[model samples]
Target: MTFFQILAVVLTATAFFAYLNYRFLRLPMVIGVMVLALATSLIVIGLDGFGLSLADGAARLIAEIDFDDTLLHAMLGPLLFAGALFVNLDDLLAQKWTILLFATVGVALSILLVGLMLFHLAGALGLDIPWTWCLVFGALISPTDPIAVLGILRKLGVSKRLETKFTGESLFNDGVGVVAFLILLEIVAGGDAGAIHVASLFVVEVGGGVALGLVLGLAVYWLLKRVDNYQVEILLSLALITGGYAVSEMLHLSAPIFAVVSGLLIGNVGRRYAMSEHSREHLDTFWELVDETLNALLFVLIGVEVLVLNYPTGALPLGVSAIVVVLLARFVGIGFLVGLLRARRRFSPHSVTILTWGGLRGGISVALALSLPPNPWRDYLVTITYIVVSFSIIAQGLTIGPLIARANADSSNPTSD
Candidate 1:
């Protein structure tokens, strides 16, 4: 399919599925669309089982979508920027230590735990996967997807403090996760990834991305201050997202981080001092639509992604096991940090439980898995990643609201606990 054809089909399907969701499903928009799309894919698969050719066509269409490139390269920048934009920087700063530990050390811990557990689990399940490949899987899966988290948070009225923790960690950790995935992938692919080299990679990617983001953000803020036109200011923000992301990629920096940093600045400092009231309002409305539209399409893409996945022998069982693996790692990672922070700070009842379950994995993990080099274990990794993500989005995404409500209730009435 040509680019426009692909766009048309995606938009048409998104609109149709969204209508169905609005009409009957009444689930969250992104989750509802995904569920419907997955159901459609399954229906196609069922028809193919009876000697029909629908599966072939469906797979072909899905294959053409290029899930990894379409998401990580094209859609991610704007999505991340939109998410980070409206985040209250003051709240985020208050949880700086928590976000820092969760984004960096917490992610590292989850990667280690998940990798080790999966390596052993794969062995027990008779899958001959190496430890490094398992670590690569961990690297991809450890970070909670910001796109998914932010979308769900919009619907669930969680506390500002907790929401900040969730949003802040998700926004930053994906960049850290991507960097780790690259380092491990290098070692797995026979690159000379020495300790020094690995550290240098992190420094260059993370540091450079942060530096570039601040520079671009400040530049945009300075320019927006001089401009009184809302249209011009909006266009400049768009330029910052598109141009800054591309430049970050060309320089081998972390584009995800670049988007987050730039968005935070533009939404906070720029909104306060740089942009006029009319421009701020227009900018917020524009980015909110961008976030909602892209999120819907992204989930729809994820739903149909099931059609093209190659499930190897024993992959089903292994994938089921991986869901447990990821959850346990998430729990431990968040629990450890929450435990430490409680000594110095206050937390809601079941804060750890909410944080663990709230860590929804979405397109980023699947995109990273799909981007893996074609090797013996790539299919296994991809299948498991899909399974884990599917469960995260559909199961955990649906129930997080109740969990927060319960936590809120308990916090309000201590005697109830």
Candidate 2:
């Protein structure tokens, strides 16, 4: 199929499912689209079982599009930028320590815990996954997807403080998580880089990306400061996102990190000092639409992707066990961060639980899993990642509304450290 043909099919599917969701399912738009697509995929599979060729055709169509390249190289930069663009700079700064801990140390902790648990779990299940590959899974799944988390949180009307923490951590941790994933992937590829070398690579990728974003952001801010035309300003912002991301990739820097930093700068600094009222409104509307459209399509793609994944027969139990492992690892990671922060600041009751359950994995995890090199365990990893992401987005996502409500009620009586 041609690119436009594929695009047409995806958009058509997205729209149909979205309407179905709006009319009957009443689930969150992204989640609803995914659920419907997944159902359609299963139907296709069942038809194939009865000697129809629909499943093969569906899988072939999905396989025509490279999931990893589309997401990691193209969609992710803009998506991350859009999410970061709306974050309130002041609120994010206020929660800097908490965000930092969660995005950095907290992510590392989750990776470690999840990797260890999965390694042992695989052994118990007689799966032949190596410890390193288990860590690869950890790296991919550790970060809460900013797109998924922000989308759900926007609908929940949660506390600004809690919302900020969730949004801020997700935006930043996504970049950090990708960096961790790359590093682990390198080790798995038998790269002979030492500990110090790996540390240096991290600094260069992360630090260089931040530096590049700051430069691009300030340059755009300078231009926007002198302009009053909302159209031109909007165009300039587009250039900043697309050009900045492309340049970061060319320079071998972290495109995700660069996008986030640039987004924060533009969303906060540019909005305040650079853009006029008219310009700000237009820019916000444009990016919000972009975020929504991309998110819907991405989730639909994720759901349909199951059609292409090779799910081994004996891997079902391991995949199910992985879901529990991921949730427990999330709880432990968030609990530790919240507990430590409680030393210096009070937190709402059940903050840990809310954060844990609210950490919805989405397309990024799927993309990372898809990007894995050809290995004995690649298919198994992909299967496990898809199952975990589906549950995280659907099951945990559907239930988080009540968790947020409970957290809000408990916030009034926050316990002091």
Candidate 3:
């Protein structure tokens, strides 16, 4: 399919599935669209058993879409910026220490734990996957997708403090996770970089992204302050997303991090100080629409992507087991940090449980897995990544609402605690 044809098909599917979700399914729009798309893919696969060519055709089209490039290069900056824009800057600052630790150290810890566990599991199951590749999976899967987390949190209306932690961590860890994934992937491909060199590269990418975002954000803020016209200001914001991300990419920095940081600055500082009331409202509405539309398309693409993945002989068991392993690693990795933080400060009841389950994976993980160079282990990793992401979005995403409610109830009821 040509690029335009592919766009038409995806847009049509997204619109139809979105209407169905709103009309009957009544689930969160992102999750509902994905569920419907996934169902359609499954039906196609089932029909393929009877000599139908629908599955093959669908797979061909999906393969042409270049999921990683479409997502990472094309969609991610706007989505990340939008997600960060509405966050309460004050609340985020209040939890700055928590977010920093979890986004950095916590992500590293989760990667290590997940890699080691999966390595042992693969060996026991007679799989020959190497440890480096397992770590790559770990790196990709460790961070929560802000797009998924923010959408659900808005509906659930969790406590401000807790929501900030989730929002802040999700927004920041994505860049960290991507950086880690690249480093590990290089190692897996026989790169000969030494430890100090690796550390310097990591610092440059992550820290430099944040620095670049600050510079871009402040420059935009100055521009917004001088302009009374909302349209121009909004266009400037768009430029920040496109130009800033492109610049980051060219400089080999973390574009995802750059997006989030600039977004937070504009959303909070610029919104408060630079823009008129009219401009603020218009800007928010514009970005919100962008966020919703892009998110719907992303989830739908994820749903249909299953048609293209090659499931290996033990894929079912390995993928299923991966779900458990990821959950366990999340608990062990971040739970310890939450526990230590609790000693120094108060945390909500069952904070670990909330954080673990609330860390929903989305397109980012799948994109990273799909970006892997073809190797013997690629299919299995991608298959399991899809399974884990599916369960995270569909199962964990749906139930986290109730979990938050119950936690709130327990918090309010002193007797329960």
Query: Rank by lDDT, descending?
Result: 3, 1, 2
User: In every candidate, how many clashes are there?
Assistant: 0, 0, 0
Question: What's the lDDT for candidate 3?
Answer: 0.90
Off by over 4 Å in 3: 149-152, 409-417
Report clash pairs, candidate 2.
none
Q: Write one digit per residue (lDDT tens) for candidate 1, span 1-417.
A: 898998999999999999999999988889999999999999999997789879999899889888899988899999999989989999999899989999999999999999999999999999889999999999999879655555556565556777788889999998899999988998998998789989999989999999999999999999999989989998999999999999999999999999999999999999899877888899899999999999999999999998999989999999999999999999998889888888887876687788898899999999999999989999999999999999999999888877766666767632121
TM-score of each: 0.96, 0.96, 0.96
Q: Residues 1-417, candidate 3, lDDT per residue (tens digit)? A: 689999999999999999999999999889999999999999999997889879988898898999999999999999999989999888888888899999999999999999999999999899978988899999999989755555566676666777788888989999999999999988887885699978999999989999999999999999999998989999999999999999999999999999999999999999999999999999999999999999999999999999998889987799999999999999897778987787776776678888899889999999999999999999999999999999999999888888877776777731121
Cα displacement (angstroms), candidate 2, residue 108, comes to: 0.6
Which regions of candidate 2 deviate over 4 angstroms? 149-156, 406-417
Q: What is the lDDT of residue 347 in candidate 2?
A: 83
- For candidate 2, the C-alpha RMSD (Å) to the true structure equals 1.8
